[model samples]
Target: MTMPGRTRTKVCGLTNADDVAAAVDAGADALGFIVDVPVDTPREISPERAATLVGAVPPFVSTVLVTMAPIESIPALHERVGTDAVQVHGDVDVGAIDRLAGDCDAALVKTVDAAKPESARAYADAADALLVDSTDESGAGGTGRTHDWTATHDLAASLDVPVILAGGLTPANVAEAVGAVDPYAVDVASGVESEGGVKDHDAVRAFVSNAAGASADGAEVSA
Candidate 1:
């Protein structure tokens, strides 16, 4: 299959409808909602709240339910939110992922820590896509820090599935990350937030713009 030529942007960890609107208005291709994650973060919201916000999203723009819930609980959480995709973090069950694949229609994205890119191999065949994230003491994601881009680059090149790069990405550095990894997509949460749950709209716009510029730069080089 041919991969998408452009580097897509996903603005995540939005807690309210207004923040959701801000991200969409900023031209984010996808918006993520953290729902009932085991880790404590201000971004985590009820499945019902995620559902309400997800439902409010306009068509053509994707909504993602980001969580670390048990594999068995995913179907219910996904059902409640009815998101277009699900980003699963932390320790995940491969067999359960396979089962969840059969149970739900949302595309499954398995997140792997950048420190352990090899761990991604197990899910490369299972998930529709893979997300490479920077993990910290807090949890799988929500780390306002960057990881080794060299590792992420190599992993993205080797993976058969589309790779989404995440962690410590801000408008200032996302272009550089995009240029380095050439990922299929880039995801950000804390990077674009004014506080924990509020979005910095200007930062959101710059992030998306820089990602696009990076894609254009790559295309120019390839040509």
Candidate 2:
């Protein structure tokens, strides 16, 4: 996939309509709602709530549901929430993802822990995009700690799908990240949050601004 000249921003873990609106107003290309049950994070929302939040978003703004469940759950979620995409964050098999792709009829974003590059590659083939994240054996993301960017960079370089850099990205270092790895997009949760799952609006704005600035510089260089 070609690298995007403007780094797309995905604001994850939104539970309410206000948060969803905030992310959209902050120039987010995509908004993620955590639907993982047995609730890993404080931002986890029910399918009904997710539907309400997704409804609040305007057209052209993508609504993505992040889940760790099997592909079987996607249909019901998609039917109710009307999501534009699904971000799978777990040990889901590629076949399952392919099944999800066919069933949900939405873009698939397969997330792999930064520690497991091999597994990332295996999933990348089946996904529309790959999200390189921090390791959390508990099945919860947004740890507020960065992983090895070099490893993610190498993985992105080798992959054919769009690589969305995640795992503790902040405004201060987002430009550096864009310069170093050149991901198709950037996903952030705790990095732009005042607390786990609660977004900091200014932080979100700053992060997007920095990424856009970097993209401008990158485009200029290419031109």
Candidate 3:
């Protein structure tokens, strides 16, 4: 499978098996399952459910689990769910992120709100990737608000690890995002949702198509 340049797409907040399949079919390079409980988003799936969804994914397609702060149970969770990558959010320390990656043996992604560039950078050494998201009062992801992409772009340039840009991304604006930030990946949830956790298939396809177009253009420019 040819890896996309510029911005590979990650369809996040997937719940049902059908949605998972749809996301893959729609050309998502990765799928994100929310493990953060008591959240409003539709993507929150139980460990057993997540395992089932993960199993359905084909080779080269990544399955990512998103968790909240205080990553105490991540080791066991990672072992049980068998996810390709783990993303931790909320008020998590850099040391906790390091331990989670080392102990759990899963690729780590440390997420920081776009407002907090310094905090996000603090975990740059620990995490395999950085996810820049919008600040939310609920502490759960999938909010439609956009962060400062300019700041995120600067952050991505400074970091050695890959940066996954999130927050308020849609088919219309994703091309501009790729041109600006040049992220390794772009994760979206509410932007493609018909309602909260439920994904609209057409939206998903459009997002993937737009992102692919942007990636192709970026590659041309680089070449």
For model 2, what is the C-alpha lDDT against the true structure? 0.81
lDDT tens readout by residue for model 2, 7-113: 88898888766677788888999999888555457878888888988988999999898887656987787788789998887677788888878888789888888
| Per-residue alpha-carbon lDDT of candidate 3 for residues 123-201, written as tens digits (9 for 90 to 100) | 8899988888885865555677777777787888887888888889998888778777778888899888888779888
TM-score of 3: 0.91
Clashes of each: 0, 0, 1
For model 2, the run of ten residues with the poorest summed lDDT: 214-223
Best by TM-score: 1
lDDT of each: 0.85, 0.81, 0.80
Worst 10 residues of 3 by lDDT: 214-223
Question: Which stretch of 10 consecutive residues in model 1 shows the poorest summed lDDT?
Answer: 214-223
Pairs of residues clashing in candidate 2:
none
Candidate 1 wrong stretches, greater than 4 Å: 137-139, 216-223
lDDT of 1 at 213: 72
Clashes of 2: 0
Off by over 4 Å in 2: 216-223
